[model samples]
Target: MKRIVIALALVLCAAQPTLADKVAAPIPIGIAVAQTSNVALFGQEQVNGAKLAEERLNAAGGVNGTKIALVFQDTAGDEAGAVNAFQNLLNRDKVVAIIGPTLSQQAFAANPIADRAKTPVVGPSNTAKGIPEIGEFVGRISAPMTQVAPNSLKQAMKIKPDLKRVAVLYAQNDAFSSSETTTFQDAIKELGLETVTVQKFQTTDTDFTTQVTAVLGANADLVVISGLAADSGNLVKQLRQLGYKGLIVGGNGLNSPNMFPVCGALCNDVLVAQAYSPGAVDKNPVNKDFAAAFEAAYKKGPAQFSAQAYAAVQVVVEALAKIEKETGKKIADFELADLRAALNKSLRTGTYLTPMGEISMAPSGEVQQKDFYVSKIVMNPDGKTGSFVLVSE
Candidate 1:
């Protein structure tokens, strides 16, 4: 009888749950972007923005007083890298949601992984067409190039009414640049500008002599170049150096402070289409507050990529709060699968006043943002510093 009692007590004690096991812990949010490699120019800014979001949220008591944690996985500027990063975040870190894979091409390859696993993903800068159509779990804060890309062309034509012979150039290897070029072409047609020459180049190529010579040969009055910051800035510098500049208009890719160092004084007089503008502080208190906070931390106005990444994290945090409110459970206490599903659904139901102005997630994982602006690049005499001066709505 003594042996039997001792054995029974041991079994019951072994089955009892411990305090550590029962108590929920801080929520985990995953950030997957290129923290290294060529894309890191943009990805580093994204990381900074996400960290700022974490700091501000935690300081203000982070989602009903429960702390939130960020898990970073560098995507390293390639498709395979993005896939590996997402896998680690989902499987190893057990993160509730993920916020990256920078380039649109990378998103096309890696977003499906998260969608299949039922994890929510918010793309900060994937602006190619059909990005939101990837799956129920994928969405982006970046507006499609179709919506905002044309405004700058129109503004350019307005600035130069004689800008009739238009030449369009884009990096063929990039999905976003390809899509953006198509939009630019369509807009050029709509605006009744004559298409003089359409040029193509690879993103990795540094020399634009052939393309620049072609544009000059065509005697184009206005030039449109669609490529990432490094390549696009080089294209602009080469175009200027080759004495082929009439009026240069850039795709969304050139709308970054990173382009300043790449193009130097040559980046001046370049018109860029923007999804978010610091001038928006008047109508958007969120933008105003974010700009102030970001300037305080980084000593400069936040770029669109950084602001969009900040908004992505903001969406996840706010959506998680909604899940907790409706389900009456702490974030860490919710089952991972159920939490992911619930957060995806909750994020689509509300409009978030983000740094990009009033924005919301569509049921199909598309972003709906209200305002867009066009700006001109104004570089200081130092040839290395600049700002985007707002020119049009």
Candidate 2:
């Protein structure tokens, strides 16, 4: 009888799951961004940033020794694609939180789904106004256009105090560009500059001859462009080719090195408003480490998109760690729904040292970033390579 009882006890012990099994199971987080289409230029950088965060966090013991797994879903630069990606991450992948859907237009469509599903979302590049107001679960690391869009104009005024006429152009189809242009126009009016013309173009439009002719007709001394990489770069190139020699100020949308290839030699001297700069090595040690890792991986400096995406990942991980410490329970052991709810609450309560500098979230889910920058694109003589040389902060 004793031998039979011992044998049954041993079998029961073997049938139960072990702590090792629980530790081995990674906590899933979703990354939904455009990996295809014209927006890929920005999306690809975001992917690189998030991947680096995953590797670094896992190596350092993620979420109190519970590893994190980043499940990727390509948003493909459209509303429908973003919706599909969010649905898959929420329902199929069962992610705790999500980061992305690159454009504000896509975010408008996709963020609501996550909000309704009670999943937390961090916007890496969706800078349109009212992004955080999408829901209580939605927040962003990217600063609003109100903070970032006016810096370039201020910098331009410093360079040319006599500058008068300003022509504004933007991608009308893009929600970000549309919202950003409003801010730009307000700045122009405040500075008492004449509004020579306002031109609109679709994100898909390649032929900008009509827009270029209108800019020339007005003889605008300064041309401000608010559009994405491909279209904005092409517009800058066309403006230069058609013989407009005045200073060109680009919006936050053109704040990437990807603009170099699109406009070539003409990309030089375009002033861009920036939220992140890899050149700020002396200010923050975290930025120094991030920039080094990025350069090692890509053989080039990181852009704003990369830095913001990395910050988003860091926010999630740190919040989880906080939860684990407060509750004295591993995040992996918490019910998924409970853990996610805790994370949303924690994200709004802390200040983070990110590549963008020290930032904290307002109760409204807006990121209150301390630093903003304006830089001028300095192209090499080869016209194929360039860097954003910081001018003001």
Candidate 3:
């Protein structure tokens, strides 16, 4: 009879789910970004940054020995794709947080899903206006155009003190570019430069002869472009090829090394507003460590996209760690809803020393970054390699 009872108890224990079955060893965090499509140029860098962050954080003991596993979903550069990715992350993978959907346009489309689901999200590269205001659960590491764009214009004006007749160009379909052009236009007016012409293009555009012609016909002294790496770089190439050269100031969208492949030697001396510069690694311990680890892993210098992505992952992990300390329980043990709420609160309460410099979010979910810069692109003699050399103090 005792043997029978023991056998029955063993059977019951086996039938019930085990801890391993209920909770995965490495908790999953969703990384939704463009892995295919034209935006992949920037999205690929964001993927690299998130992967490096995952490995580094895990190596650092991983939120008190609870490892973080990243699950990537490609948004494919469209609003519908971004919405689908966010839905999968929220309903299927059940991630504690999400970091991605690369562009501000995607953020505008997909963030509401996460907001409705009460999931915490961090924008790695969405820099347009009203991003954070989507919801309390939404926050971003990218500073707004207001903080980063004006400095580039100021630097450009200093370079050509009498600069006038501005021709502004942007990717009309992109939320960030469309909004960024308005900021650029405002800055142009504020600086007392004439708005000679405003031209529009799409992110998918390759032939920019019409826009280039307009810029030249207007005889603008400074050309301000607010488009992504590919379109903006091509515009720069066509502008240089057609022989319009006073000063070219690219908005936040052009702050990528990927621009080199499109513009080549023409990338030289282009002024771009930057939120992160590789040289900044020298001043901050966190930046120094991230740069070393990122280079060791990728064999390349980390750009602003990568830096911001890394910072986003760090924000999530750090918040998870804080919850672990406050609750006296492993993060994996917390109820998913409770954890998400706690994370949203934790993300806004502290300052982080990131590769982008010291960053803290305002109550409204805006990132209050301490450093903003304007860098001039210096293309290699080979014409296919380049870097942003910081020019503004």
Candidate 4:
């Protein structure tokens, strides 16, 4: 009877641990970027950066020695796609936090899902005006149009001090391009430059004959474009082919190297405002390490999209560590809901030295980044490749 009682006690003790004592091993973080569609150019870069961050962070003992798994769901460059991706990541994958949905329009549609669920989301490249205003649970690593867009215009004026009339063109269907054009227009007005013409096009449009004709008819000395890779790149190619000798200013959307092939040699001399630059390696140690790692992995310099995505992943991982430290509890042990809430609170409370430079999240979940750059594309003789030469910082 004594032996029987002892065996029964042992069996009872060995039973599955209670929910309070169970640990959530291998933390899951969702990456919901557009891995398909026309936006894949930017999305692919973001995925590269996020994956690099995951590998580096995990190797260094991720989140208090527990490994983190990145859950990927393609948002596919549309509002519906983003919403579906968000739903899957939140409900099925049960990720602690999410990073992405590439464009600002997607963010407007999808972010509310996470916000409503009280799950944290960090936008890698959603830079429209009202992204942060989405919800307390939402934030972005990318600088808004209000801050980053005007720099390119300012740089253009510096290059051509007597520049007078400006033509502005954008993708009417894109929330980002629309918001960015507003900034460009405002800056043009502030600089006392006349609005020669404003032309609109859809993201799916290939031929810009109508728009290019309007720009030339106006005889605008400068042309500013606010659109995505394919459309913007095509616009550049057409503008140059039809003979617009004046300077061209590309919005943040053109910051990717993927724009190279689209415009060929025509991409040269196009001015763009940057939030990240490989040249920053000389000044920032973090950027130096990131650049080295990036070059080794991809055999090319990292672009703004990659750098921003890496920073987003870094932000979430660091925030998780902060939560573990402050709460005196392992993130694995907290309920998923509790961990997410804690992470959102902790993520906003600190400054991070990212490749983009030292950045912090505001109480409202807006990222405060210190540095911005303006660069000009200097295409190689190959015409299919180019580098964004640092024009100013």
lDDT on C-alpha atoms for all candidate structures = 0.88, 0.90, 0.88, 0.90
**How high is the lDDT of residue 257 in model 4?**
80
Which stretches of candidate 4 lie above 4 Å from their native place? 1-23, 204-210
Please give the lDDT score at residue 147 for candidate 2: 89
Candidate 4 on 194-255: residue-level lDDT in tens? 99899999999999999999999999999999998889999999999999899999997788
Q: Candidate 4, 239: how far from true, in Å? A: 3.1
Provide backbone clash counts, one per model.
0, 0, 0, 0
Across residues 1-393, which tens digit of lDDT does each residue of candidate 3 receive? 999999999888764422322234588889999999988988999999999999999999888888999999999989999999999988778888899879888999999999988888899898878899999989999998978888999998898898878999999987788988999898888878799999999999999999999999999999999998888999999999999977999987798787999999999999999898877755688989999888899999898889899999998888788878877888767777877888888888878888888898877788999988789999989999988898964
Q: Please say which candidate is ahead in TM-score: 1 or 3.
A: 1
Q: State which candidate has the highest lDDT.
A: 4
What is the TM-score of each predicted model, taking all chains together? 0.86, 0.87, 0.86, 0.87
User: Who is ahead in lDDT, 1 or 4?
Assistant: 4
**Model 1 C-alpha lDDT per residue in residues 199-244, reported as the tens digit of each score:** 9999998999999999999999999999988899999999999997
Q: How close is candidate 4 to the true structure, as a TM-score?
A: 0.87
> lDDT of candidate 1 vs native?
0.88
Candidate achieving higher lDDT, 2 or 4: 4
lDDT per residue, candidate 2, 87-140, as tens digits?
Answer: 999877888899997998899999999998788999998888879999999999
